[model samples]
Target chain A: MSALLEVRDLTVRLRVGGSDREVITGTTLEIAEGEAMGLVGESGSGKSMTAKAIARLLPAGAGVEGSVHFAGTDVLALSGADLRRHRAKVAVVFQDPRAHINPVRRIEDFMTESLRTLEDVPRAQARTRAADALEEVGIDDPARRLRQFPHELSGGMLQRVMIATALLSRPLLLLADECTTALDVTTQAEVMAILDDLRRDRGLSMLFITHDLELAGAVCDRTSVMYAGQVVETSAADRLHADPLHPYSAALVQARPDVTSTAERLVAIPGRPVSAFEAPSGCRFAPRCPHALDSCRSTEQVLTGLDAGRVRCERAATLRGRLLDPTESPTESEETADA
Target chain B: MLRFLLRRGAMLVATLLVASFAVYGALDLAPGSPIAALTGGRTPSPEVLAELNARYHLDDPFLVRYWNWLTAAVTGDLGQSIPLRENVSTLIGQRIGVTASLVALTSLIIVVGGVGLGLLGALRKGPVDTGVVLVSTVSAAMPSFAAAVVLQFLFGVRLGWLPVLGTGTGFADSLKHLVLPALALAATSVALVTRVTRTAVREELDKEHVQTAVSRGLPWSSVVRRHVLRNAAIPITTVVGLTVASLIALSAVVETAFGLNGLGAYLVQAALNKDFAVVQGISLVLVVAFVVTNLLVDLAYALLDPRVALGSRAS
Candidate 1:
């Protein structure tokens, strides 16, 4: 399928003092029609910012430069009523649903208001569609739930309601930015399952921004790793774990405790995560990578496609065989596995 | 909701009872008795004085006298004014409209003008904000009597737009006469309410729900109307409610300055003459008005935000 949303060379800068500070570098990514792509990173990696930028929802005065093409139209170029119509087709579910839902308003008003007023759907018709959307997200007795306020619902339930509210507008793209991060393990699993089923059923494209690599590996069709405002690697979710070309992606996959690994201690990546302001001149990860060469520090890194995915490391081609999979514990039986 | 209202009603009764005791105590502790005021400063005969004391229950303890007064007051008999020789309640009843009208008009301006300016400052946030803050600070710092004098000089004398004296005869006339005093009374409140509303709206603007509403494709107008206004109402109502007592105090000074025959003037005259019955009666009414105004403000939470109003029932 053709790309449903294409974000090319997107950069976001916020004016902090007299000067502009880079929040997101020139990051490029895409989501195909009916595809679920995961943008994974540690805190302050600009994953959520990327999701917001895609929807053109940045706060006023934020300097945004890039091309965001959705269904053959430039999202950044749309203005007036066109922008309003464009926003309706793109829905976002943020972390902490309770925080995003107005406490003074009932769930029904919060859910149906956009549909009735913005979408120009009739009240009764909006209510009907809202109920159906709620049911699609696995919420039972939606009519009763609608009358309750945000404080009345639990965190997990509120998250489901948020998802349901997003789907009510029949958005072409759904942006879930750390949506399940605030939920518990069981509730997180439940929410993820619901999202998977709903996306497949509706053929809706989704960008799931998360920090949990394992979670992304489980639910996403493809995963893109972000670090200090740059996408370092993009590959099939399962393939990323078994063969990560970027050293940062390799360290991340190895950090997760595997149920199958017999090793007791996990390998820790040295040094702290850098902010955009603290970024180095070349190969963003060179300072921390164990395989860094002098060239890695002198030359800028560019994403080069190899096999089924892309990598940004300067030595990705030469180091491919050696970087087989760090996720495998040192003591695990390599002979027992099929190559 | 019914239970919440009932509980608030009971609290109001308790508040009024305590206020009545304090008012009655101050009068009882004062130098002369109501009978002394009745006698025009002359000593009465022993038999006449004893008969007066017995009939009026002036010889009873303070609490007993308070109970008698309260019981009679509740029955629409607030006792006869010593100086006026008219029913205390009746005197106040006649003048309540004047003061109520003044207060109502003043509060309307304070709420609408203050909140409107506040929203403008918070939404626009440049010269409009600076102007609002400067005005609020200046007016808030200015005393009500001083404000009254300046308003009288500028609007009443120079402009000759409104009457400079007595609470006018009819509704329109009275309202016209009340304009100066109301504006004077509203100045400080306008200052207070505007600051409160501006802060509230500014805070609400930063709330996540506001951003969420915009992302939902709601227009700027819809997002502000649906989210910002209602959320800011809570803090604004609180500021307005708490200002009632100060507003009452301002009315007394403003009424005297404007030479309006309102209940505020009645209160000031009664206090100075030590007309114990009128003083105590008006004091009790003022206390009750303050309490009831607050109760109504509290009840408004039920409509503005269901979370608070439904708090007791939901739990």
Candidate 2:
């Protein structure tokens, strides 16, 4: 299947506090039509930045060297009405529903705004559609909810409202930017189920951005793990979870506390995660990688294709099966193999 | 809503009563005697003094005199001004129109100029924002009396465009006469409202909802109006209310500078001459105006933000 959204060599530089800092550096990913792709990373890993770039919602004075193609249209080059249309076609759901909704406006107004203003739909008709959308998201008494302000609703309900509003534009791609991170676990599962069902029902493509690697693996068909603003690995979601190619991805998987296993301590990757602008010229993950060779500090790393996936690490073949084993260090494994 | 109104009304009455007592008691506590002002600083014969004391209740205790004055005040009798020898209420009634008109004009200018420039600064941001910040800062720092004199020199004397002295005869001429004074009165408040509005709007624009609004593909203008301005209205309204309420106090200087025969000017003259009755009456009226203006601003809050209104209802 042809990719519905393709982002190639996307680099974004933002002017923050009077200086230009690169936030996203040469990140590449693709989502096929009607397929859900997960972009998993820790905070400051450029997951949100990539979504904002696709939506054309970067802050003013931002410099973007990118080619974001959605439905075969170059998103970066679009301006005026075309940019607006692109925004409508690609919907984004942010993490905090309360902060992402206007407190003073009624939910009806928030949901119907795009229809009323952009499509020039009449008020009553737009309101009816909003009610219907609200109903689809499992909100009971949709008519009353339509009249209520955002503060009147709980966070989970407001998130559902946000999801309903996102669906109002009949968008081709839904960018879920840590949408469930702020909710309670139960609410998060419910919202995730709603989103998954709706995406399937509408044949919609989704770029689910989150810090939860397991949750992304559960929801998305394909997953891409990002570190320091670069996509380090892309493969089947379960495969990436089971046999991650990059050392950083392996560390992330191991760091997560597993309920099924009796691990005594959660394995933490040493050192703090660096932002894209602060990353070194060589492998961005080399500083913290346990298997880093001397060459890993000096040589440039690029995404190399292997076994139905891509990984940026130079020693992917040598370290393939040994990544998941926590007991054996790289040197010990090499010595044992030689013996 | 009715409960809220009733509670607010009771508070208003209590506040006014306390304010009136403070005004009445402060003048009573002053060193100079009302009798001295009444008698033109001359000593009267014993019989004459006794008669004057009987007429004015000068020998009554402080509480007795306050009760008598308060009772008569509630009945529209504010005693007679010693200097002007006129009924205090009648004098105030005549002068209230001019001050009211001046205040209304100044408020209009404040709302329009302040909100407009603020919105311009926030939305335009770079050079325009800098210019607004610079201008508003200078204006805010300037005293209204100094502004009054400068405005008088520029518009009234140098340009010979507007009349600087006295309240003019008719509506149109009166508006013309009041323009300079009103501008001077509004100068500091306009700057205040502008700074508040600009800050509120800029903050609202940065909110995530505003970003969501943009991402929804709504027109930029629509997003600003529906999301940014609506959310910013609370703070803007609060600052506007505070500044406008303060205009009453600041108007006294502007009125005296421009020589407008308004209540503010009358109050200043009455205070200087120790016309206690006139001062008391005007102070009561000014207090009422301030309280009523604040009450209106509170009502505006209920209208602008449903959270306040609905929260009250829910309680």
Poorest lDDT segment (10 consecutive residues) of candidate 1 chain B: B306-315
- State how far residue B22 of model 2 sits from its true place (Å): 1.1
- TM-score per model over all chains: 0.94, 0.95
- Where model 2 places Cα greater than 4 Å from the true spot, the runs are A325-329, A332-339, B82-85, B309-315
lDDT of 1 at B4: 82
- Model 2 clashing residue pairs (backbone): none
iRMSD, model 2, in Å: 0.7
Clash statistics: count for each candidate: 0, 0
Per-candidate fnat, comma-separated: 0.70, 0.81
- lDDT score of residue A207 within candidate 1: 94
Question: Ten-residue segment with the worst summed lDDT in candidate 2 chain A?
Answer: A330-339
Q: How does chain B score by TM in each prediction?
A: 0.94, 0.96
**lDDT, model 2, position B74:** 90
- Interface RMSD values for the candidates, listed in order? 1.0, 0.7
